[model samples]
Target: MLNAMSFAHTVGNIRHHFPGLPTLLAKATPERSGDILAGIAAKSAEERVAAQCALADLPLQHFLNDQVVPYETDEVTRLIIDTHNAKAFAPVQSLTVGELRNWLLSDEATPERLAALAPGLTPEMAAAVSKLMRLQDLIVAAAKIRVVTRFRTTVGLPGRLSARLQPNHPTDDPAGIAASILDGLLLGSGDAVIGINPAGDSPAVTAHLLRLIDALRQRFSIPIQSCVLAHITTQMAALESGAPVDLIFQSIAGTEAANRSFGINLALLKEANDAGQKLNRGTVGDNVMYFETGQGSALSANAHYGAGGLGVDQQTLEARAYAVARAFSPMLVNTVVGFIGPEYLYNGKQITRAGLEDHFCGKLLGLPMGCDVCYTNHAEADQDDTDALLTLLGAAGVNYIMGVPGADDVMLNYQSTSFHDALYVRRILGLKPAPEFEAWLAGDEYARLMLEATHPERLLTA
Candidate 1:
């Protein structure tokens, strides 16, 4: 039996669960005002304008005026203009998968050199580089088509597929893994999304992420999106022991508990809201993305513990998703709700395609649904499941789907499942096929050479 209620109660219940979450209600004191404006001024001109607009109709003039000073010297403006022109006028060059692979696996990649480069890297940057390299590897392996693949990768696997075709090799350093992925992408295929699970908030993880960011900035100038900060509680612990705070949260436990500790719902809401405001003051509303939190449907589910124990019923899952959505609405514009049940492995077989279409996909899309293709062991089964899943997702108004290639019950031979999945998704979304691999590879090579020639220190120095 389930109790249905209004959106307000749902939000209220969520507040009851997480009592310690911060609130944004504290009056904006004069000092806080200056901090906010200083943060705004540090942003790019475009960002400054956007922030101004956000504050325009609000009681923020005193804060904005006190914090932001007019730029008279025009030095920052000149720098911005010059950087844009440089990129616009830059010539492109071609790179091959084989060439990039050789560079990554070459003897030059000694432990000493890697260590030397480590200090300069950050966890976020490392994560980004890892993704780029993984994409490069997939492109090289397929050698045929140009495609842009975006998904997170786990520690030992190569290719985006969860079901590894090859045995897990022992020598797989996270850094090396990233290097390989980027090499593949540079040789041309498409962009990749790598998941960063920092192992124990060590400086090492932070360094890795930084290096990755640097490499991507040097090569593509693309912004990294879809950050997956899983099991935030454990991540915070690691950071306390010398990990980078920029890449890890300070209090995942307090954050998670506050969300659930009944009496403090309003306070939690305030905290999240305040954090959102701080993030907004610094970037175009676009850059500061936030992932919403919700109770998990089952223990066997893939996400961390705080997300568990919500029950397995579709009604229950949907209810929880909706509740979480309402609670997070004030803070996050983008969210990923798990529509699939926790016992998906056992129950997935019983789930008729229509059940997925109507209940899970349809209902969940009221919030931005994060379709998790959990059972990807068999490609055919996975594809059948996903085909049904995607059709339903498209109908349900889902905008994003997260999955690993060949990781489920489906066996997507390089040509069919992976290629067709990307193709179908692109078609459904009305996106054009990405640029050709040959062209991308050429551009990547030029970028690599340019970095090597002009700012090798960016890679080697912190």
Candidate 2:
């Protein structure tokens, strides 16, 4: 059975972090949150959850309907777009690194502004952006951002690594989902997160999956948590049903209205954070939020980084995505760098450049960065392209990578790192999982089995 009392204690601790949540929860009696108390051992888990919900007077529905900010055109960018002067050059789209450097340094140079146009830049163009920048530029940019790399309020040990166990399926089959999770864990991959984005939008489906994950922990004997990447309201339904949900997952954009359009705002996020804190499923630290972001989420919602609809360069907006993570202690923050295909990157070169650039930027700004070193069928890339980038990112100190079955996201239809790929990186770079998880994986049959398969020399021989 779940520890309701322990959960209550964690919930009480949440107010210490988010000072704004107390008033919304002020009505509870006995100096304890009634919703958290409902989860105490005196009541069966279900009844306690119901009592808690009733006591809190919580509205467990997707209710935010904010507007997306419009993109604004900047004057310098406007003149270039209007005059179309670059089109006269020799296929300006295919410029070399030297050519790109000359172009940026030529007239009214703005490396940051020009860098913003990178999503539309070709691979060659992105390479120039990555290599040619002066250290001062990155130093200047890093100084402006606020970030957090550890669990809330700094409690993580460094020189460790983790991976997101992305167990997803098209039909949302419980057995299939369980099998994939087994695959990832056996390969030593669930350190950062063990979560799923349910293919179906039904609350029942999410509840069913959450229960399956809860039951599996004992059978597998591993310390891990699950995320049903459903609507926050849907997750609330599962939470009401008394399922084991560790973190609330969402894809946040840059603008407020856009986040609301996706049914989340600061207030809603706070409520979810408070509830997760109360649940206390985190094994690494106290953070209970997981977020996935890519460039263009803001514009996709009709919000622009600027006032005149000229979109903000992706780096600025992407950094803004990292900035918001500091609001809550985020356990995992993935910048799906190349998942959007070449439409933004234009080729493998640009895709590779963006992966490294985003990783460096997020890390410098204090985020535990994970790269979805992935590519779609439409992208001008293959496994080899991603493999090279993965090695580089591993060398660059990324906190984690995505662990899917065979590196194939059957549900999302994107190709990423597989369980074996995680093992490969670990073996080559001498990296290990989070300390506690490594202890849990210690001497288990599955770990032995994986060892025999991955490194037969580690096995006892006659």
Candidate 3:
């Protein structure tokens, strides 16, 4: 909860950024302010959020001077905004869902800008804004930012399904990592990003894995890049060791403290970005950041409350994390949606819901969205649950999926989609792997397997 004056000052930066807000907010009268606050109590969660956006649009000093109400909880302030600015929202309210969808399809709106504006809209209103556009709109907006990432390899998404090789090992052994990389490539699943999380946590170990992945990529001469998920400092060490690193990877949280706990700061990220840009090894421009995020990281880190104007549901906080990823211009953002387990997500139903929500939010905000399609040992989930999530996201225009050995993560002790799963979805939906890699696979021993995987009837005869 914020005092009227403090809340105003807090999101003042946001207000500053939203053009024409001051003029728009200047028209609210005292009587309407009372009605707006009164009306807010009865609305749904989406409606309440919409109302809050209206209040946030006003000048704090003037709004405080009016002291429309005692300004109790932030929710109160939010509802008051809705009550006060009913007229502004009236136009939104009156627009049919189809009309809003068509408007979004037109050149008049963008996912990035709409994301910035969505916090003030009800989910219904936001849906009205994006119902038809959904994955298609998200893909376009994300590609605009996704294209400039470091080692910018386009995943050939919506056209071709993409998969990553997560050959994580307990010791970060080069042999073990290389074997996993080869396995994924053989399975036609390394098109997303061939990366590892060095559980050993040693910069040297991370560097070794980085070297191993790059070496294999070159040895096979496949069109791919590598990610080593270590602290920026550790990755920098790998870079200093002359490892051919393609992407800078980090696990980001929704708030500043949680992000700091992960040993990341904007300054540190900028330094890594600078280093990655210097590598400049991709045919695409310098979009190089790779981020993995889950819903509970902020709550786990105890940084959920500091989200400022960003609402505090798991979905909102998760989206806020994507906003941070956007700042660094990441090429890929994986919402480890179900990987956090039932402690945060409860059951498969909750997990599935959160996965879809996170995907929609991330893609809507224009991050090259991929889903981990994962679950942990402790989660009340199974292979069937994961398959459902994988299929759902695939249909939703996902950019990539993880390709771990047999869909099992040895180092992290989680269950995620495997190379076969990628094949399953692609074969079912007629999705291809990225063009360059698919072409490479076509020329080799993989040609038969690729063909069989494409048309399973061939497998029965073979």
Candidate 4:
């Protein structure tokens, strides 16, 4: 099903980008090598190399070997290689706009395939897809060239806080809901991070996190590594009050929120930088994480209001959000999570899959792109459509995703499909699926059996 040479070329490209992985592989034992190879086999070659390098403890150059030659090209491999090489070197040399256009209009333009496959596609839909593809191309190009004149890498805290849970009325039993979500995350073999939105200087939320930490320790033997707080002042207070705050950060929802929060954001950053100066003195060490949110779908009332009536047009909103993000780069360079949902509700209207993909590629060049809450319709629904959507998103370079299960009845089933899609993406990215991943999702006895078959060493390495 896969062309080996093309696969090799992609892997080679990944190796080129991250040069510390091969040494890690070389240092692994036979069993570890097998495990690593299995992991790599589960993902795309490029992703496999990326993950390896990302997690590797070695220096960058150790994984790179300029003398390591790739297998010569076949037709498919040649095309992929040319495209890859062109993309890699385009900025330094010459890559014509015409060439880029032709590439999109080619058979590989994802929308063309979707049109042939999805009965829902119309001519207008096709045009939208093309526009998104071009826009993504432009954004990626711009990100590659954008210069950073200022480096205000430190972040600060706000004096207050605010919080909202989606579906407005979250389950009355917040503890039960939290447990279910965390259980799914720990049990599932996917990367998971919890985001806490503690509003109004409430100590209750801090207590809730304390309970979570205890539960994780007692039940799962997992350590609470960090917390991503939406408000800075509350974050610092939480940290001071024995909360395991590994990284200090802030969250921005939309344009108006950006404007309203800009002063606060800057003030907090300046304060944090100032504090770091006093604490660390002459030495420079980063004790905080700074993340800026780009434009996202108005999934909540607050988000809608905060975004200042930015219409639900994906392209326009994305452009505006990107402009703000670029302007705030100096303040947000520590870590920036780009756009969230073009949620399913507005799927055909404001944001299309293609548009989301383009926006992601554009904003997440050097930063992490957090894939916002993944909500699907149901398992009984057309999962192939969902799979196609996931495929498109993955191809556009989404490394972090928030997967919530059982948000609704349909979402429960959809969560299963989401896991499947995640596994598929993992394979495409060259990451190995955990053993018994399917069985665990199926809720089989094998699930518990596989849990008992844990390799603590592997878990430690991971």
- Best of the candidates, lDDT: 3
The global Cα lDDT (0 to 1) of model 2 is: 0.57
The digit string of per-residue lDDT tens for model 2 on 1-462 reads 111111121233332111111111222211111112222121233333333333232221100111012212222222212332233333334544345444544543343444333223322122123333443333333222223233311212344557789889889877678777767777787777777878888778887887776665655456666788998878877887787777788776555655666777767777887888888665446778877877545545654334322233444345546545546667777888777655455456666766766665564434566788888888788899888877777666567888989988999998998888888877787777767677777858556556544543322121
Q: How do these models rank on lDDT, best leading?
A: 3, 2, 4, 1
How many clashing residue pairs are found in candidate 3? 8
Error of 2 at 191 (Å): 1.5
lDDT of 3 by residue, 381-458 (tens): 889999987887777667788999999899999899998999999998788887777787877646544444454332
Model 3, 73: alpha-carbon shift in Å? 18
The whole-model lDDT of each prediction reads 0.28, 0.57, 0.61, 0.32
The global Cα lDDT (0 to 1) of model 4 is 0.32
Worst 10 residues of 3 by lDDT: 26-35
Candidate 1, position 207, lDDT: 48
What TM-score, over all chains together, does every model reach? 0.40, 0.64, 0.70, 0.44
- Winner on lDDT (1 vs 4): 4
Candidate 3: residue 354 Cα off by (Å): 1.2
Q: What is the C-alpha RMSD of each candidate to the true structure, in Å?
A: 22.0, 21.5, 11.0, 20.1
